[model samples]
Target: MDVKRISGLGRNAAGDLAKGVRQVGPGGQVIVVRPANSNFTLQEYQNFVNNFKPQQPGVTFRVVDEAALPK
Candidate 1:
């Protein structure tokens, strides 16, 4: 399956999510990676989904929470 990987949390994570949706379209899956204590809000993540358009039937988003990733 074609997958879009988003690394980081909060604003950074959302940015990646937006990029994924834009580049991969609504037919692919999105993977968001984030730190444990980035103090990010769920709304940030939802914001990405809200802006995503042309929803495809098989489209999906997967978030990976991983801290200590190199910036």
Candidate 2:
């Protein structure tokens, strides 16, 4: 299965960023790593993940929130 990439930006902005893994596959794992915010909520995260779609069914899609690397 081809791997998909989702980029989560903005620190402490999970509301706008959306905080959860999207389209996770059976074997793949979605990794979220926003700037550890004390006020990050789960609902917003859910919204983020919900907006994503798997390119193909049973493809085992996964997400990863990484530290915004320097440009």
Give per-residue CA lDDT, model 2, range 16-69, as digits (tens): 222222344344444444343424444444455556443434433233333343
Worst 10 residues of 1 by lDDT: 1-10
Q: Provide the RMSD of all predictions against the true structure, rounded to 1 decimal.
A: 5.3, 8.5
Lowest summed lDDT over 10 consecutive residues: which window, candidate 2?
Answer: 12-21
Clashing pairs in 2: 19-45, 25-60
Q: Compose the digit string of candidate 1's lDDT tens values, residues 2-45.
A: 34444334465555566666666657777655445656544554
Q: How high is the lDDT of residue 28 in model 1?
A: 75
Best by lDDT: 1
Per-model lDDT: 0.54, 0.38
- Candidate 1 regions with alpha-carbon error over 4 angstroms: 1-13, 41-58, 67-71
Top candidate on TM-score is 1
Q: What is the lDDT of residue 53 in candidate 1?
A: 47
